[model samples]
Target chain A: MNFVEKKILEEGRVEGEDILKVDSFLNHQIDVEFLNEIGKRFKELFKDQKVDKILTVEASGIAIACICAQYFNVPVVFAKKMDSKNLDKETYESEVYSFTKAKHYTIKISKRYLGRGENVLFIDDFLANGRAALGIKNIVDQAGANLVGIGIVIEKGFQEGRAILDDLGINLHSLAIIEKMEKGKISFKSL
Target chain B: MNFVEKKILEEGRVEGEDILKVDSFLNHQIDVEFLNEIGKRFKELFKDQKVDKILTVEASGIAIACICAQYFNVPVVFAKKMDSKNLDKETYESEVYSFTKAKHYTIKISKRYLGRGENVLFIDDFLANGRAALGIKNIVDQAGANLVGIGIVIEKGFQEGRAILDDLGINLHSLAIIEKMEKGKISFKSL
Candidate 1:
């Protein structure tokens, strides 16, 4: 978390008061070494839980979830944001509202991948309004699977995402939590 | 490669005449162990090449490229399928015609990540029409980067993807090449 926070301070660009773009290393261009560290951290946090599958919503979440899945020794099931012809017809779908994109999109996962009574850990690159996380959790619930915990690379703590998931009683862990972004500067929550 | 071939024969589903869905373990739901094998295989195939970065398209390709980047000990840069507000305005863009979706979409990669003279290896889940592959190649060319080779998880040999890339003089490698898919029976090319 220190390294992630340091990276954010050094490399993350704060556009306006609400957006933190980490495309240089985290999202668009991925640093496999850093991702491996993130994987190890997630594993350390949720070492007690039995994670059968790591769930995420594409397209940014796929890389983080897949890298973290390697540490868990579990497969990753990413919910597709757009309905693709390649996806199966029988799927567990959940509608999510994206504050960033300012639209509602359906996230879907094949019913065959997530079975009943399976333990799933949700992972994502950024947790803002917690819409994507909630949507993935909804899909996990619909599949009759247990939501073990949520792992986030960066959480916008100034936003209500953490509180929302906390109110739902979902165990959530974020590597770097940004407390505030003021005057193009990011402030992290002191652990 | 044998493990990948066996995985395809077991979990891959054939839909219609040309669609082979391997979402069970390849795209939608990713098997990290299998992906590790894929990474090793890709490394073995391109062991002699000097790969500086692993390039791939967003959504499905991100997972495989990230996994494969580990073996190459390089970073992964995935092209965005859509123009998100978060994406930088300065990008290397290419138009790709999706044969499955029957539409042309613009894929963008940030100009900062890909540098001039960087050695890149393109990786993807499937290679059919080779439009996406060519599109990425175009972006790499635009950046004045060197494309060492292209790595695909599955190649539809019946299609013209390989031929197009071959015509372009690109060294292409596919883990499992499906020679024919008839009545849901899949046949792979002999190694």
Candidate 2:
């Protein structure tokens, strides 16, 4: 978490008061080595939880989730945002509203992937409004899978995402939490 | 490669004549351990090539590329198919025609991630019509990067993807090439 916070401060570019652009190392151009460390940290945090699968949404979350899946030694199932002809008709779907894009998109996973009584760990790149978090939780619930844990690489602690997940009694772990981001300045939630 | 082949034979489902669904391992629900074998094999195949980066498209390709990036000890940059508020406006964009979905979409990558003279290796889950391959190649060309090689997990030999990539004089390596898929029966091209 120290390294991640340091990396964010050193390389993260703040746009306006909300956006943290970490495309250089975290999202677009992935630093696999750094993610491996994050993955290790997630594994350490949830060592007691039996994670059968790592669930996430496509695009940004895929890299973080896949990297973490290595540490969990489990399969990663990312909910598809795009409509693929090959995706099964029988799916557990959830809608997530993107505040940035100002649009709602459906995230779906084949029902066959998640089984009853399976423990699924939700992993993602960022948690802000908790829309994606809630959407993934919806799918996990539909499949009757136990939501073992939620691992986030970065969390905007100022946002309501944490409170929402906590209200659902979801055990959530975030590597880096930005307590404040204003006027090109960012503050972290101290341990 | 044997394990990959066995995985395809076991978990891969053929829908209609063109689609081979390997979502269980390759795409949707990723088998991390099995993909690690693929990562190693890709490294072995391109051992002589000095790969500076592993380039791929979003979603499905991210997992394999990220896993493979470990063996190459390089970063992986995936082209974003969807627009995002966080994505830099200055991007190298390409149009890819999705034959499966019957639509065209633009894939973009921030200009900062790719450099002018870096050696890049393109990795993906499947290669069929070669639109995605050509689209990615276009981005690499725009970045003025050298594409050292293109490694595909599965190639539909009956399609034009291989021909298109080969026409570009690209050094292509496919772990498995399906020679034919008819009546739900699939045949592979013997290496």
Candidate 3:
């Protein structure tokens, strides 16, 4: 197993059946050192690609993207989750449905940050239904920016997210892919 | 003027009367390298404090806190702005009144991350009205953690945030203090 998979096995908690909570290290309480290793791994995976900027949704994705940006030496542009008055007037927005929240919300990026023909690599903490990634891809399309690839820290392989992104022909690299999760047990997909 | 002050004049925008938008580098689109400088400055400001962990609120604060956490070599625990089923059941929550949203919301941090007598250094992008900072302070207090101090990238000197934090006897440091911001003009407080 790779480093991320090992970390998952060590720190991740499986709640019920669908949830593999890595909040201890990846999300809630961030382990900067471990995230740096994850960033290095991502850089190694996508080193050949011409990356201009890193894109992600707010909150969870911000930490990983910012840390990962150091290796690429690029700016990180995060799509805001809320409809705030503070956001720019001219923005590229997409509708995203959150299963956790049980509602659809709008995610936006200021037009000034993303320009036409720019290369964007979408990064996030987890990939489940791929709705959030698709929403980000929509924003990238609106800006006429190229969605070069996506880098995910963890992927729920049991879900259809991977297949959908595969159908779209987008390059995706996940550090850890959990194929099975149950109460008191978790298993990762083999390379 | 400091580096932050200079960057503010170069990149920050003044919208209407009260808003100074630093979206280009500070918020919407993040400049990772610039944030490294910010992290360095924050370290210099609070180098004496025994900070066990860095704490901040979600969304906007995550990026800055994550980047800043590197300088301190500590884990960052951010309070979730929205309530979700994904979060831990046992949490320390604080109610914050948002002037922009014009409503009250609860911010929560899991009980697992913070502990009694743990030294916490609160870091964020902006300090306005002190509502968010106060909310985080409430969480820190509930956890029985020692709030060593607060480090902010920018402080609205005209706002009551500084006064409120000062009244609570919290050690607060803001890199750039905007004393006045009118349409087509901006001024910083002389250090």
Candidate 4:
């Protein structure tokens, strides 16, 4: 987590009051080395939990989830944002609202992939409003699967995302939690 | 490559004559162990090349490219399919036509991520008509970067993807090459 926090302070871009972009190493352009550290940290944090599978959303979360899945030695199931023709017709779907995109979209996973009574670990790149994470948890609950824990690379600590998940009594772990970002300066929560 | 081929023969579902669904191991529901094999195979195929970075499209390609990047000990830069407010304004953009989605979408990568003279290895889940690969190739070329090679998990040999990349003189390697799929029977090219 120290490595991630250091990288965020060094490379992360702060835009306005609410947006922080770590595209250089976190999301758009990924650092595999750093991701390995993140994987290690996630494994350390959830070492005691029984995780059968790692679940995440498309695009950004795929890389982090896949890298972390190696540590758990489990399969990864990425919830699709768009219903492609390639996806199976029988799927577990949940509607999620994107605060940045300012719209609602559906994330889906094939019903055949997630079975009943499986322990699922949800991973994502950023946790702002916690809408996407909640959506994934909803789908897992619908399938009667147990929500083991949630792993995040970066979390906007000032936001209500952590509070929402905490109220649900779900264990959440973020590598780097941003305490504040003001006028292009980023601050991290003391872990 | 044998493992991927075997997985295809066993878990891959053939819907109609064109669709070969291997979501169980390849895309939607990802097998981390199988992906490690894929990562090793990609490294073996491009072992002689010096790859500074791995370039891939968003969503499905991100998973494969990230796992493969670990073997190459390089970073991954995945092109975003949608324009987000958070993405950098300066980017290398290309339009890609998706056969599965039946729509054309633009993919963009931040200009800061890719640099001149950087050796890039392009990776993707499927190579159908080679449109997405070519689109990514265009972005690499635009950045004045060198494309070391292209690695694909599954290549529809019956399609024009391989031939097109071959004509361009791009070094292409596919783990499983399907010669044809008819009557729910899949045949692979002799190794």
Worst 10 residues of 4 chain B by lDDT: B80-89
For candidate 2, write residues B148-181 as lDDT tens digits: 9999999999999989888899999999999998
Ranking by DockQ: 1, 2, 4, 3
lDDT per residue for candidate 1 within A1-191, as digits (tens), equals 49899999888999987999998889999999999999999999999999999999889999999999989889999899875998888999988888888888898988889999999999999998899888888888899999999999999998889999999999999999999999997888975
* Residue ranges of candidate 2 with Cα displaced over 4 Å: none
- Docking outcome class, model 4: high
- After TM-score superposition, what is the CA distance of residue B55 in candidate 3 from its true location, in Å? 0.3
- Best prediction by DockQ: 1
Tally clashes: model 1: 0
Q: Using lDDT as the measure, which candidate wins?
A: 3
For B56-166, candidate 4 gives per-residue lDDT tens digits of: 988889889899999999999999997678888899999988887889999999899999999999999999999999998999999999998999989999999988999
Docking class for candidate 2: high
Worst 10 residues of 1 chain A by lDDT: A80-89
For each of the candidates, give the backbone clash count: 0, 0, 0, 0
Model 1 ranges off by over 4 Å: none
Interface-residue RMSD per candidate?
0.6, 0.8, 0.9, 0.8
lDDT of 2 by residue, A1-191 (tens): 49899999998999998999999998899999999999999999999999899999998998888888888788999999988878999999998999879999999999989989999999999999999999999999999999989999889999999999999999999889999998989899975
Model 4 TM-score?
A: 0.97
Model 3 over residues B99-165: C-alpha lDDT tens digits?
A: 8789999999999999999999999999989999999999999989999999999999998999999
